[model samples]
Target: MSPQPQAAVGAPLSRVDGRLKVTGKALYAAEHDVKGALHAVIVDASVGRGRIASIDTRAALAQPGVLKVIHHGNAPKLPYRDNPASNNPPDGRRLRVFQDDQVLFHGQPVAVVVATTLEAAQHGASLVKVEYDERKPSTDLEKAKADKPTTYARGNAEAGLRNAPVRMDLTYRTARNHHNAMELHATIARWDGNKLTVWDKTQWVVGTQTELSTVFGVPMDSVRVISPFVGGGFGSGLRCWPHVVVAALVARELKRPVKLVLNRRQQYFGTGFRPAYEYRLRLGSDRRGRLAAMVQELDAETSSYEKFTENVMYAGQMMYSMPNVSQAYRTVPLDVNTPIYMRGPGFATASYVIESAMDELAAKLGIDPIELRRRNEPSEDESTNLPFSTRRLRECYTTGAREFGWNQRRAKPRSRREGDWLIGMGMAAGVYDTARMPAQAHVRLDADGTAVVDAAASDMGPGTYTSQTQVAADALGLTMRTVAFRLGDSLFPPTPPHGGSMTMASVGSAVLDGCNRVRQQAIKLAVEDRESPLYGAEARDVIVRGGRLHLNSEPARGETYQRLLTRNKRSHLEALGSFAGPAAKERHSFYAYNATFAEVAVDAALGLVRIRRVLGVYDAGRIISPKLADSQAIGGMVGGIGHALLEHTVTDHRDGRIVNANLADYLVPVNADVPDLKAIYLDGEDPNADPLGVKGLAELVMIGVAPAIANAVFNATGRRVRELPITAEALL
Candidate 1:
């Protein structure tokens, strides 16, 4: 039998929601209208570490339209129940709003003022004075004491390092980064009787709902969260923050809807950011560049209250073939909020350290950077001894090298110069785990030949709405316009949090399952009906296209879904699509791989650097939406540029104040910073990864970007600086 032709799955379709966004019809969290909703502004702590000494609310009460001022002194005690299912980290207690007078970090919410208008709330909040006994804060990562190390070991690293022919020890530092999504963290909470409804800007509505319910000592079902649109969320919205609690608590107390929005400065304190890191790496390799052993020491900043941790050491365990490997990852509790996942999370940080060291090793060995990686590539996951589902990193390197004109690059440093600008090319390998969580989607086929797919997922500027719609359209044999994908609602079918680049592999698979089931049901009915043209045909032999069921061999003989359903007296068909996840214990290692190449030009005398070109080739299983994938790849490259040369969150260690809290001071890549950027996705699918054959793409796009740019800098000049945001001083 001939295979069915694909028209939507691999097509380069534009975003389905682009028009709504450009036309200003899309509504965000703060845009939701609630009758008589009060405005709220929170008063932040003046000190990073301190105890509240006194509070004054007399002047705040005199503000026009000021209704109430909430603080630890006057606010009611919340349940603050311990919830194991909440998004809180595994260790330490979650922050309880208005439950204590101790300030653990700078920018902690000390009080809130509620008023009829935003201006009144701002004035009242300013008038609510707070006095605290300030204490010196441990905000600097280098000086802070680290907790007991979490260690991992395999073979004898000490012996391997002593016996190796070549050895290198290097240290790298990465600055703290924040997820500055265009939309502020805002929430509008309204209560009626025992139920609460909230319109919030979050990546995980279910997680927020659960946290809010537990905080208020209410049933989980009593709280409903609606967020039809989000400006952007990298990973900041993965967990519920204290401000969300404040909004709900204030709304419940006032018996009126309360709207709370964090301004640009408050966002730094309100949510999480990518913690600054200091990574020390030591490598022992043979004469041919095969790694003999490695030892890694990692330290990262975390909130003093919560011991937040990410998968920082996972890449060291399996990225290359090494018999002797040892690692110690320690979290340094400091006067700061807990760090959360940014674009690539821990892997991006690790890749910069490891891959940059790889380039250094290549320079010492006088071998091509790509050649050095090939010499150490492992056939299977060395850590787990499991075969890979799909390991196409070799293809990525070769294809990327060819397309990027790597052959023209000079192996020697400072060899290519045009006037005062020195041009050099560098490449690095990247990999991210193929993670899939259990997810479900509810699909409905209406009588009018249209379909609706619902899931409690989020877009977060990754094109989830458009990509899911394409998946459903292809599965249900309908046009893109005929299928509607609904997400970001608690009432929809439950899905995993919309980060980790797993939405496509997880939620997409669920949509496919549900839509396929509905199509199969229709096929069964038509084959069994006597009047149908598809009658007596085997179910497997029939295929659907454009809502018409036809024999695979005879495309002209078929009936529209509406005609067949009308004859059968059916209004709609519904089905639940679900993916239960990999088996309890997986037999294979699954991951997406990429090879990133960067060409950079540096001004030798003035210490100025500029990117000339960047190309990323990825082995990310399937391309559900080619156009969207391109956008994701380019965006990742832009973020990488920021991480390498622009973005930094400055802190005043004496008082634990964020020095650069606003966008102007905390730099990001503007349009002028990005140059010629390109991406190429290797065409293929992993059957073991997911039903959709996708291993994940969003995070993979950014995994090795920083290291690639850094290596290019080294090739341009003879300098090997190990710090992030390669500044002019470092180059000089």
Candidate 2:
């Protein structure tokens, strides 16, 4: 088959759903209007860890519009079957909502009040009272006992450290962070006989469907999940939370639709968060900055019910060249909700520590930070001993340094000042492994010269709808307006989770294949039909442009798809395309690389740090949409600023309660906090990574942001605060 014209693939296009979003036409999970849907509010336990001793619901049940109060004593016992296919942790049992009196964490859902109106539900919930046998909670990461460690070793790390000329040991701490998206976590569930349907805020519809089916002990086909639009989900919606099941359970019990929207205060515990981490790194290097050995010990927070983990050790082994390396990762179970992936996840946390340590090492050796990193560049991935499919860190460094005026930076800290403020600039390199999974997409081309492509993919915020449309438009030889892309429906062709920076590589490739197949089917009909204009033309020499099939060499010798399909008396042509993911025996290690730079001004008297500018240069394969890519880059930088200087989920260890749960108390970067931000993409594609040649940009943009800012703070004030959220008190 001939290649389609490259018109829309790399074009800068606006989001297809932008107008709907701005006009409030895009319906989020809580906004869905289901007929006869009752409201439910969960009653939380006051103590962190304890068992419910007694409950009083007489006053709540007497309220007007109150329907029922369901607790462990009154709620029927659910099957609570094990579901390995979902995102639940594998180590321990999941929390069964309202199943027993045991309270595993503070704010555990002990009971729920159902009423015809949301206000009634809230009032009834507030009226109800519950007493608990309170117990002290193990909420402190430092004090809690850790589970067995997951260990990795490549060489004799301790011996290498002992023999190296220079050595350093550093410990860094990062606070927990909540997603805090604009829209709250919500679910609207309705049961029709044995079948269940839910409109949820989720990143993966099929995952939710499978989890709900398994939880209810029903067939997979008996559950349906629909999520057409999401306000934002920084990995919080990656799994089916307990509230989703609670909504479904209540709806089934009452034989009516149930709507549950977690209030802002409840959202803190209702959804997953980015776990707090304590990382200890030991490093040994030669005088010239060549790495010799490294050892890492990490402890992260997780719930007592289940153990959660992330890819925290990958960077320590492969980011730089090291002969000897060892790692031990442990999860400390606490009286908290399970943690999930957030933006960059493990890579973000690792990059902050590694990059900061590199800066410290450079300062110690009197060598330039960029030059020190160049000296440690690896020839291949030492972890797997495989050649890199595309490692462009050198190019990223050169590009970012030149673009951000790196040469003007002073090597001495606190040397450059502007009246009451000190200025500094810092840069860090980041890498994230490219991930792709099996996916399928369905495409249909009608006689009207239009195409529709769909998959069970989602767009939390990264413009998946527009980018997929671009892929389909070019492949099907249709205009952007003529190619319609739909998603977030379990009925569509299955796709992998929207996180992990894999949607474009996996789902877009499937859409491309499906569209290509449909376009080929149309061309075959035109070439073989005796009544067609290009009946004798070779199929290989034929090309499609704007719904017209023509010879590649002659533009005038073709007919529109409408003409060909109308003459053939065919309504439409459809195809299901799939990408089988990466090969079993991978030939190369694939990862996206970036160099992030930041400029900051610090006020010593006031102890305030202001971000002046941020620049990110990426070698993330081919960019499908430049405008949307910029949006992602800028948003990531803003988030990085928050992680470095402001965002922190403060918990009171006395009761395992989050004191700053509301947005009013929690600080995030607003319009005033964001500075001049820019993103530059290296021009090229990695054919080895995936069919689309995209190594995933969304997560890569966020990996090095926090580290860059943190390093800049040290350069400005000569103060190395090992902890995150570099507050004014720390500087003082």
- Candidate 2 pairs with clashing backbones: none
> What tens digits encode model 2's per-residue C-alpha lDDT throughout 1-732?
567799998889999999999999999998988999999999987889989999999999999999999999888888888887775354788889888999998888999999999999999999999988899999999999999999999999999999999999999999999889988989999999999999999999999999999889999899999999988998999989999999999999999999999999998888889999999999999999999999999999999998999988899989999999999999999999888989998999999999999999999999999999999999999999999999999999999999999999999998899999999898898989899999999999999999899899998899999999999999999999998999999999999999999999999999988998998899899999998878989999899999999999888999999999999999999999999999999999999999999999999798899999999999999999999999999989999999999999999999989999999999999999999999999999999988889999999998899999988988899988889989989988
Model 1 C-alpha lDDT per residue in residues 237-295, reported as the tens digit of each score:
99988999999999999999999999999999889999999999999999999999999
Q: Candidate 1 lDDT (Cα, whole model)?
A: 0.92
Q: Cα RMSD (Å) between model 2 and the true structure?
A: 0.9
Error of 1 at 292 (Å): 0.2
| Model 1: ten consecutive residues of lowest lDDT | 1-10
Off by over 4 Å in 2: none
In order, the Cα lDDT scores of the candidates are 0.92, 0.93
